[model samples]
Target chain A: MRFTSAQRLDDGVLEREFTLGEIPGTLWTPESAAPVPLILMAHNNGLPKADPRLVARARYIAARGYAVATIDAAGCGDRPPSAAAEQARADLRRAMRAGEPLDEIFESLVGPLVEGAVPEWRTTLDALLELPGIGGPVGYSGGWTALGIRLAVVEPRIAAAGFFAGGYVPRAQREEARQVTVPLLFLLQWDDEGNPRQRALDLFDAFGSKEKTLHANLGGHTGTPSFELEDGCRFLDRHLK
Target chain B: MRFTSAQRLDDGVLEREFTLGEIPGTLWTPESAAPVPLILMAHNNGLPKADPRLVARARYIAARGYAVATIDAAGCGDRPPSAAAEQARADLRRAMRAGEPLDEIFESLVGPLVEGAVPEWRTTLDALLELPGIGGPVGYSGGWTALGIRLAVVEPRIAAAGFFAGGYVPRAQREEARQVTVPLLFLLQWDDEGNPRQRALDLFDAFGSKEKTLHANLGGHTGTPSFELEDGCRFLDRHLK
Candidate 1:
């Protein structure tokens, strides 16, 4: 992990960002050495790496002794891609869906853009998981890329998944979601225009395991409140710790 | 306003939607009869009438003894029109921009679609202003319709305006914004694709009056948190009450 910037919150709280893999992210962790669980957060489509809600959530989770990282997916946040590169990335994503090995796909798809930082995520997670008291399970949150990370990487380390406004394309991606054995929690908006309610319901119904659950909130596609984050963390604790 | 559904949050907390004009909207008003300031909220392009943040905001304002209404602008919500009718409405808006009276434009350009319980908003506001204690002050909050409403009406009864994610044609609309003498608040997102930040900044800088203030948040074109609404309510309360 590489340091980007640091700041002290109004109430003497500390916030900082670390560059991990292709994604540069903000990390909020308590000062103590006690190893706590870690959460990797990916923001909604239009939100940036330092979105206030995501920052607040990191702070909240940090206060609870969990390390929280809000990462900007490729082509988002301070690191934006050129127009041609962005189209190429989208095309590469389409190619990967046509059945490519995870490592080869990562190399061909994300490697050129990320370069050296591509392997940093695995190293960082390995280090965190190896910490003395950090025995709790790992979880992922936010939209598309978060789902991509959860589905593509069959990480035995991930104990559960909390999806916020993440939609599975029925004919295309539903089968991938069926393979996830971990307890999956879906957070959806009742009237989200981007991903309609039925899409979420369909995913819930198709989940091969009965361990999955769905919670409907009143916000739109990008409306996940702090309370929901707390609930998600608690759910992760239940399954992983 | 006609009540549609109600959800009671903790004790004395109520969230409900009502059929107002041609749109279904959520109304958050104090339980008591005491007169308070009013805010008419206009949603973003991707949101429905019952977005959770909107409902939360209405409930929050109502809890604070203020009246707030979240309305679905024309051609949205339950009032979605046929393609031809939608084109007619757009033409009517264009005609109104050309200095035509609203009633005449409505008759010639958009009369076919007008029927049933759809209230003419301007007429409704005119009637509302005549009622005792209802003349307090009015304000509009929305993106696409913010400038449209400002341009369509000659002089609204509103004392202030808080626009979120607007400023789409800043150069062309400079003259229209100049006509608004009310203290204006513009909330813009840093990386909004829909409404470019540069355009919003240009529009803010071009405003003729010092009464205008600009706020930047870290969300998409949709919206940020309740700060805009809260500040808007405070602005309206100072002028209206």
Candidate 2:
């Protein structure tokens, strides 16, 4: 994973969009002379690193004094949506939502998606750490996909994570979670239209982190409530600070 | 994993529904004099070990001179559906079907499911091997869940494996597949309603097995065609015989 270029977004923040080979991503770091904590913010499934919500969150987190990075998910962001795959994914998700049984299709879509995303995340983390002042207390925040859950298990650099609603727990990775001791702030939307509530509960139940907390609010899958997001900031603060 | 009880089915197959502690499972073995190969058969999502289709497959495989075992999934069979969790899983799967973007939820579901399952399978395999004539070469057969994909990666005793299409490839588990050199016979239903074709393709692509074969049939997520089943049996015969 190599950084292609870095640009000064403004006086307070530096923004760099890079290609670790084919994978595209954007990194935002506070323009500080001293090293700061880094937050690897992952976009929700289907959303890109440049999505406004992510951009806003990155800015918000960066303003709070941290290096924030968001990468284009597989087939998202600067990358072209995989041909035929994007439509097939949409159709599969639609059928699943229509109360039809599409577990197989869901598995097919999600399994490889996670496989593709996790490696890129690790690579991005490796690259981020190499940059000056982009080190110390690394963390991750993402929605529904809980990609960080796997990261927490595999990436020792991840000291804390904030996982939001929208993802189900895979059976195999459930066991891996048992090895994750990272402090975690898990957010859940009560009426998440994209995920089941129990999956969150199950994942929370499976987490080996003695410091994990579940923050649930009354809403669908969307931008997390401010209070919950604050709770997350505090959680990351406790660990990353 | 412990044996609760053993019953002799009149059909020359000894049926034993045992508990590897809390996990419930049933093991069926041919009432033969010689030690035989064992086939770990898993039901598709939401189906129990006793599901007739699985039973029929188990019986057919047993009649081919092998012992067969099927365990109830986390919420399946005798395990009371995990209390309030089943509905959540249903909704999650629904949202995924609707294409609402629940990759994280899918990961949550599939990760834990595999985490919970891989151990159960290992335990079950251990117990099955303890029984008379249930030793020698071991194999696995299952549907979209493809629970044994991890077993293939982790379990060296697995001489060969037949993974039916419909399950997604977990991101964390993908690298594990590269370690699986087990002779593999991957079965795919051409138009599997539950899984996308690409998922199967990706998994097939990820597998490191030089001796792997893809047996695809044209149909929704239904029964495998006879010819494909026969081809799978032959594949098994080559490894397990």
Q: Pick the candidate with the highest TM-score.
A: 2
How does model 1 fare in lDDT?
A: 0.56
Show where candidate 2 strays beyond 4 Å: A1-11, B1-241
What is the C-alpha local distance difference test score of each model? 0.56, 0.73
Find the candidate with the highest lDDT and give its number. Answer: 2
For model 1 chain A, the run of ten residues with the poorest summed lDDT? A109-118
Those runs of model 1 whose alpha carbons end farther than 4 Å from true positions after fitting are A8-13, A20-23, A31-33, A85-124, A127-136, A145-153, A168-172, A224-226, B1-241
TM-score each candidate. Answer: 0.41, 0.48
Give per-residue CA lDDT, model 2, range B111-167, as digits (tens): 777777888888878877887677678898877335777888788888898887744
* lDDT (10s digit) by residue, model 1, range B35-76: 666666655433566677666666765676656666565555
Per-candidate Cα RMSD to the true structure, in Å, reads 14.5, 22.3
Docking class of 2: incorrect
DockQ of each model vs. true complex: 0.02, 0.01
Candidate 2's error at A88, in angstroms?
Answer: 3.9
TM-score (C-alpha) between model 1 and the true structure = 0.41
